[model samples]
Target chain A: MEVVHTIADLQSRIKAYRRRNDQAVGFVPTMGFLHEGHASLMNKARSQCGLVVLSIFVNPLQFGPGEDFERYPRDAERDLAVAEAAGVDLVFMPSVSEMYPSPTRTTVSVSDVTTRLCGASRPGHFDGVATVVSKLFHIVQPDQAFFGLKDAQQVAVIEQMVQDLNMPIEIVPCPTLREADGLAMSSRNVYLSPEERQQALVLSQSLQIAKEYIQSKSSQGFTSTELASLVRAHIETAPLAVVDYAEVLSYPTLEPFDHSHSISSLIIALAVKFGKTRLIDNLILQVRK
Target chain B: MEVVHTIADLQSRIKAYRRRNDQAVGFVPTMGFLHEGHASLMNKARSQCGLVVLSIFVNPLQFGPGEDFERYPRDAERDLAVAEAAGVDLVFMPSVSEMYPSPTRTTVSVSDVTTRLCGASRPGHFDGVATVVSKLFHIVQPDQAFFGLKDAQQVAVIEQMVQDLNMPIEIVPCPTLREADGLAMSSRNVYLSPEERQQALVLSQSLQIAKEYIQSKSSQGFTSTELASLVRAHIETAPLAVVDYAEVLSYPTLEPFDHSHSISSLIIALAVKFGKTRLIDNLILQVRK
Candidate 1:
């Protein structure tokens, strides 16, 4: 329930906690306006770790000039209640000035993997995510860090960053938490009008359709084109759903699927537009090896 | 004196050592082939940290094609001796295969500042350096990291990385160590022929002359074209020295000299080619307030 502000205070507290016998720390980093998705992440962290530390930072570095940095939803009191309900221990909420003093110039990038999908749409977005996540990882020095698979490309980028940087914390990929209607939850869900919220359900349904297709077939792999067409048709058919991109990719790598790619490693990734908000969801179907 | 090759072993050992107490860890990351310059960095780390860990890695991602990645010098035994003499506790010398498993694909960058100086010539060089250094910072988990001002641009880039990422480690910049004749020390100093060695001295001597010119009230800061000419002439006159660039700059910012720049932050930076190895040197002089 303790909300720390400064880096020094946080580090000192984490260090002290480390000394009082082996305490396993778990971290969940988020931009504010928490939802069930963030709660699931905290739950995952709380399940395994002695202390769960969650960070609510709407990092400006990740947002392009035209992006939703200014308008990004933030409500710390409600977020605190959600964290408390989720059994979180500490909340490390830093101010923009505290996070980035003047002359802020550093960035953490995950190379080629970051150059695709969300990276293509929002350039340097993942760099900001990777850098902020890395900072949280260092500050909390967590035993395990939990990230939801809802942001599949972000999960990939973080995995690459931790591996490339040799960070000690274990990155646990939590299953994407969805609403009762099969809509994958996101903080930006707040941005959606009631009508837009109803349309967003198509994204998750399309992903489910892809998953069901692969699960039904005893084939080696479906062509990337066929899968794309099916998902695109689903999105285009809906009045509220507009297909931003619907592609089959190699799991983790984000490379376009080929005939050589096995069904077990195929990722049906999609970006669909519902009004002003762009929501991404992917289904990674694992078949017999 | 201990050389740990595997990432797991080093991580385990470091974790165990860290458990003993809150010992301040200091780090010096380098490509092996240790010279006095590197030894001085180790000595600095030794004095500042309870445990000094030096990692020697010639990161491939930082080098472009036609760059000397394959031919980059390395001498583990010599590096070990120097590290040992300098009182380093652990020397992490990981091979490419060990540090980067086959599918490595992440990078860290420092923007703006990286877009200038060394970044201009080497393109993605600082990106590579930032990525590797970030990896090192994570792996070593040092309280402070040491860097040489010999690579003034690298120091700036790293400072950017450390700040931008909000990494916990302090970046300590050591003065550029030099040979008796004024040649700045570098691992590539080995590549210099006996004649090339003499020519390399011009890089430093030219800066020394510039320093004296500014001290003697060589024209007003930005208006002193004569002082700039003298600085360039010193390098041009040397038979083995080919001037890469010689310019007066504003320190820290690395901006070209302009009328508005504060005199207190004026800096003179130079780069020269002595045979095949390019050498760099700089001198910072305070401008009148």
Candidate 2:
């Protein structure tokens, strides 16, 4: 696999593939510290695409002040090895200066969708995500781009941006990968202490409990408030886990769940802090017909 | 020349050309009354690019609530004829419903530069232009895009967006085409009455006077306020021409002109109302080294 650090170099390498007319380029954009979750996304891209381009850049724009941008885990050698093992044809590892040599005056923003969940807690996060993804999409010019559903809100924001901008690339959303104990895999997982890591399982556990509750009450249906309270109660039982937000919202549109309507599919998302480490997890509950 | 009305049809036609690595695609996006200025841009694209795609979309997003959106001049037949004569390979004339089938939730916005000149008078105008231009750029995926220097502010907004987003296409700015009477050619010029048209020449005439003043006073650099007052005084001479805005500002940046710094290259822009028709013109003055 070829590794390139500059935009011009990446474009030059991709130019020949672009001109061939027969090859389908797939792209996977990440913030390095690659794990099984990222590997799953790259594997999916490799299964169907003729060329796979993976990018690893710790984007500072997405992190708010006091966020973990300074200590965000990065392993370039390991990341390159992972990409090569996952069948990535080209890996783009751009420096911060290469990605943003000057102050950025342009912003790509999606309204309504970016005002809830993690967006509310982390201001300007989705805007940063949308902008960097837009830059990467233009640079890669891929036929299909892969994103992990672990960051469902990020996926939704990108979907809205692509649809609104009429971008020609297709967004392929891969399923979220989990640890053996059911904790969702995240790059920030490195921040967890032994105790915090053990307590983090409460996030996935609460989601699982919500799934079962919905299954039991599938016929009668449940209010979003009821499901939220149930999940919040479960996480609060874990002494270390402090609930930040546990709310149920409609899928894709992400509107507040309405009790007046019959429940079909809803996203139960949560963010919790175990000690100093924050973790987020979600479950998409659909009524079994 | 092939004329396509739907995005799907246009994409299909351009797909083959996109696959062929050797061809360079050039794009010209317009609101479609096809004046000499637009023809000049298309001709420039044809001279340099292997494929020329012209899009005629009367973007409603760019028009203010009380602006002339409903009555925006459009001539599909004539536009196609002009494009064909100018050697355009593809003409994309999408309907309003086709371009925006649903409410747009995404916006591409530029800051600082958009808060001055025309942006001050027409709020959200540059945002609309940036969004639609972004869509067209993605759809066409052109090697180069052409814009007329006549709408210099629009060109600045687009340039900032392309650079910030790292769009791979090069922006080629073509010189403004003028009539024998010195009026800058515009589709909106059709709205002018013969008497109003005659009076509208003052828009360009004022710019010319400002240029001459700047040239004559080059030794003793004039303040922006001084040049603005000079141009405003000239436009007010015409009985029918009412000065809307006449200001001198820094180029590209469009910042308020600083009197402290010696003028190098500055943009003197003006807008005037002749009866109910509004016309705008500008001149870029550079110091002769």
lDDT of 2 by residue, A1-289 (tens): 9999999999998987866657789999999999999999999999989999999999999999998898889899999989999999999999999999998999999988888998999999999999999999988989999999888899999999999999989999999999999989998898888888887888998898888888889798677898899999989988888888898998777779676655566798899987767788888767544
> In model 1, how large is the Cα lDDT of residue A268?
82
Cα error of candidate 2 at position A161, Å: 0.8
Chain A TM-score from candidate 1? 0.95
The candidate scoring highest on DockQ is 2
**Candidate number with greatest lDDT:** 2
TM-score of chain A for each candidate? Answer: 0.95, 0.97
Ten-residue region with minimum lDDT total, candidate 2 chain A: A257-266
Please, what are the lDDT tens digits per residue for candidate 1 over residues A26-61? 989888799988998999888888888899899988
- Against the native complex, each candidate's DockQ, computed on alpha carbons, is 0.69, 0.86
Across residues B81-166, which tens digit of lDDT does each residue of candidate 1 receive? 88889999988888898877865677676777765557777888987888778778877788899998888878887887777667
Candidate 2 achieves a global lDDT of 0.89
